[model samples]
Target: MPNIQVSALAPSTQVIRFNRPHARNALSLALLQETATALHAAQNDDSVRVVVLTGDDKAFCAGADIKEMSNTGIPMWGQSERLLAWKTLENFPKPLIAAVEGYALGGGCEMTLLCDIVIAGQNARFGLPEVKIGAFPGDGGTQRLPRAIGKSRAMWMIMTGSLIDGPKACDWGLATEITPAGGALARACEIAQTIGDMSPIAVRMIKEEVLMTYTKSLDESLSLERKLLLWQTHDHNEGIAAFLEKRRPVFSGR
Candidate 1:
């Protein structure tokens, strides 16, 4: 059976679900490759403005596949398809959202952190348990965790390998929203639809600029935002014209 499932929840939103529920959707090398391929397809499709990643009701992802990892070593240890898949995840240009329900541990937690928006079911569980396994989270966990939660909190979680629930995840800023159990996916789709209703160019630039905050200085980022607003964006012109005309803006994504 296929390891990943893709569906169109909306004209502009693509939902990718991890299908390995028996394993709590543990991210195996093959599963990651399938996910990467799906992401690449979504990235190339102009009609796909937002992507929502999720898993079955049992779990968003348990972590790396234990059987595979124990036998083969780390999944993304070096230059390989796994590493490239991670790179694709980190560099996805459009907005990506995560709808986390159950376990999102270790590499799974890191993947959630990679998303632009994270919606979690109140019963969702998140952690970095690799330290207990005599390994550390290697797939953006150390870096992204600190960025999501504060340094000290991230340090505590990483060092102790403790799990946090959805409410706590939101309180610590790791999750963007907390929904009732089983409502995360629905809420994420709702948010994605709202984003889809916006101008595609605006949505893409907003994602790009927000991600730039990590690599660029505030002044540099501001300057870049200003340049785009003044000269590079066609949507802004349409927005202003529509406001003056008292009509809805029809964006061409130019």
Candidate 2:
């Protein structure tokens, strides 16, 4: 069976599942490539408005494949297919949600940072344990984790290789929501569907604007928002008319 499985959950929502349960869904080169292919396909499909990433209830992902790493070393950090795959995921324009359960460690934890929203199960555990093995998280963990949580918390996790459970993760700002055991995927899909029902153009723009806040100066961000506000689109007109008509807006993503 394929290590990764992509399935359509709704007209506008897609779910990508990591299928390597035996290894706790440890990331392999082939799996990363397949995931990138799936993400590219979803991004190109106009019908797909949101993507949900998840694994089995036992584990979201255990991180990079240790056995493979022992022989191949860390191929993802350099100019390799895995690096390209990681880039593809990071650059995906549409909304990406991570439904996490069990363990999200090292690269697995890093992957969640790439998503726009993270919904973790009560049993979920997150950490960057690479330091314990004489390695470090090379997949944007050092950078993104600090941005997600505070600097000190991220420092502790990276330096000590300790883990935090779902509630703690949510408190630390690493996770957006915490659900009951086995409910993360369902809650994530619900959120995806709600977002899908809105104006696709607005959704995309909002995501862009929020991400821009990380690097853009305040003046630059305001200028960009002003430009977006002035830009005429069918969705904007539809939204205004719907409010006046007391009805739902039908957006064509224009």
| RMSD (Å) of each candidate, 1 decimal | 1.5, 1.3
Q: Candidate 1, after superposition: displacement of residue 107 in Å?
A: 1.0
Which 10-residue window of candidate 2 scores lowest in summed lDDT?
Answer: 70-79
Instruction: Put down candidate 2 lDDT per residue, 1-254, tens digits, no spaces.
Output: 89998998777999999999999999988888899999999988999999999999989999998777644553546647778999999999999999999999988999999999999999999999999988899899999999999899999999999999999999999999999999999999999999999998899999999999888999999999999989899999999999999999898999
Cα-based lDDT for every prediction: 0.90, 0.93
Residues forming the 10-long window of minimal summed lDDT in candidate 1: 70-79
The best candidate by TM-score is 2
Instruction: Give candidate 2 misplaced runs (Cα > 4 Å).
Output: 70-76
RMSD of 2: 1.3
